[model samples]
Target: QQQVKQSPQSLIVQKGGISIINCAYENTAFDYFPWYQQFPGKGPALLIAIRPDVSEKKEGRFTISFNKSAKQFSLHIMDSQPGDSATYFCAASQQTSNYQLIWGAGTKLIIKP
Candidate 1:
């Protein structure tokens, strides 16, 4: 079984600051990396992500980057706000795995005003 390891079990960011979360995968077979954000009382929502082929992706205040050589990917929340406080997860998926995502442990992020 493949595994995705994430760093920073928890994080604190000031409002308007950038929040970064990282994930590393063992198997190169993994092709896609997606970032998800979960609120205190809501299910996870797809934040941003992309295939490793692109190397990087950016949407609004969020960005996802892939490093093929390092077998790693990361999520960056730009100008993070208080509303951005949530639990973040990094997941890797492969077509061969029936699109089942192997998830990282998760990071709890808090944004201060």
Candidate 2:
């Protein structure tokens, strides 16, 4: 499995500010990379995802709009709030690699009041 590099080991975002997390992978064989958000005392949950062919995907305030050509992806949190503070992870997987995913070193996001 190829490693996915995520930037900004930690992030501090003010309320209503935009929080952006970035990730890049070297394996072009990796089909899709998904962003997961884990709140305290809770397991990680899928926030959003982008298909290999698609450049972007958005849901509510979270976006996984990506640059497939560069094998880079991002999660954008618009109107960030304290409630949004959590550990965010980016994961990559290959079609033939079964369900096993290569995870990025997560970024701890703090949305300040």
Candidate 3:
């Protein structure tokens, strides 16, 4: 079974709008949750991450809200711009097995002008 699940395979937002992506995990052992953003040719880059100890984290226009009890997390982008259009992925990792990350099917976001 897939350890992590994400919703809304694709999304479209107007410029200066908000974009949201959500994820859920089945593995309770997962302690590290991270979001990645990738362009067409470049490798995925870490956008933000949160540990079980924190409920939410925000950096600039990006925010990550986590619900430990629900084993779920969501990423929110505020004031999304055209440049923000990209594929976003949610991942979970634990201390076991060298902390290998279990990836979720990515969400492709398109920001319209």
Per-prediction TM-score to the true structure, in the order listed: 0.97, 0.95, 0.97
Q: Write the per-residue lDDT of candidate 3 for residues 17-110, one digit (tens) a residue.
A: 9999999998888989999999999999999999999999999999999999999999999999999999999999989758999999999999
Per-residue lDDT of candidate 2, residues 27-95 (tens digit): 888887889999999999988877788887889988887888878899999999899999999999988
Model 3 global lDDT (CA atoms, 0 to 1): 0.95
lDDT of each prediction vs. the true structure?
0.93, 0.90, 0.95
Best by lDDT: 3
TM-score of 2: 0.95
Per TM-score, what order, best first?
1, 3, 2
Clashes within 3 Å, all models in order: 0, 1, 0
RMSD of each: 0.8, 1.0, 1.0
Stretches > 4 Å off in candidate 1: none
